[model samples]
Target: MAKTTRFATLIILMALACGCAKRSLVALVPDPDGKSGSISVSNEAGSVAISTPYRATTIESAKQQPTAPENIGKKTLDRMFAEALSIQPARPLHFLLYFENNTTLTSDSVQLLPGIMAAIKERNSTDISIIGHTDTVGSKEYNSELSSNRASTVKKLLIEQGAEADAIRTTSHGKENLLIPTGDNVNEPRNRRVEVVVR
Candidate 1:
């Protein structure tokens, strides 16, 4: 029985070692909107394409180059994939800040300021999205205005914390999309929030 178990483990280890020896193709393309893209890979006679909004696929597998009238060779494809990997940029990071009832001041939200600023500085973020949302406690118009104000407030704070003003874009969803859906005139604490996307 012990010999059988040892033999099975050896087979598994050999399989894993062989898998690691295979070559994989990876391509990083920027989306048309500059916010998303996709990656594709083929291994062991199978192929797959992965769609990504702000991140790159991390995988290691053998790749099959597409056949065309030009008849691109595997050597060329391998070189292209190598170059892409060498120059691929880092992926963007996301952060969320929840606001207090009818106010942009939340203890937890305030505490995130330093970390957000540090990430921006460390990653050298150039583009950022500051979107604000609110609960369904007031008229649509009023909520819209309040959400915009909240987003603006966060943007200001980010700038003061060393973020570039020109790189920040602020938008207000108002009460249109609630984190915790509720009926009209309802005050959902979780609904009042701001989302920050740093790229």
Candidate 2:
């Protein structure tokens, strides 16, 4: 009876040891994502390159979705003005001023003059970037010259309104950077405009 009891006890201990060893072995296998464990198991099967589907949206894809112009317009100009205000005039702010095509600045352009002047006065310094652009009505050279003259005119007006003359820098991009791209002969009223960047 003593021999039989001893044998039974040995069997029980062996079973318990096997169970513990099995549990430990199971634990050693890492989780697929490796949230735990020192060793990471890649889900890839072989050396062959696997192309996974991209899940994130790209900027171009986002742009492909139609959006209201008003929403963007409200955001851009106001944001630009706010950014401009933050900049010092000693570091001139750049601005883009649009004008109607084939039309010279009349009272309408003058109407914005006060606001422009106020903006400059608020800065209390001069340095400015004045760029002019035009529609595709005339030869490129002529258009360039015309745009330059228009910018110069604006510069002169700003000087008259208390802005320092030497502080202004001007350029003309004539028939380039059109606000609206139309046919070669097509004239866009919005394209014939001057852009002032105060940087």
lDDT (0 to 1) per candidate: 0.71, 0.58
Span of ten consecutive residues with least summed lDDT in model 2? 50-59
Residue 169's lDDT in candidate 1:
95
Cα RMSDs, all models:
11.6, 21.8
RMSD of 1: 11.6
Q: Which parts of model 2 are misplaced by more than 4 Å? A: 1-103
Whole-model alpha-carbon lDDT for candidate 1: 0.71
- The alpha-carbon deviation from the true structure for residue 197 of candidate 1, after best TM-score superposition, in angstroms, is 0.6
The digit string of per-residue lDDT tens for model 1 on 160-195 reads: 888899989999999998888899999787888988
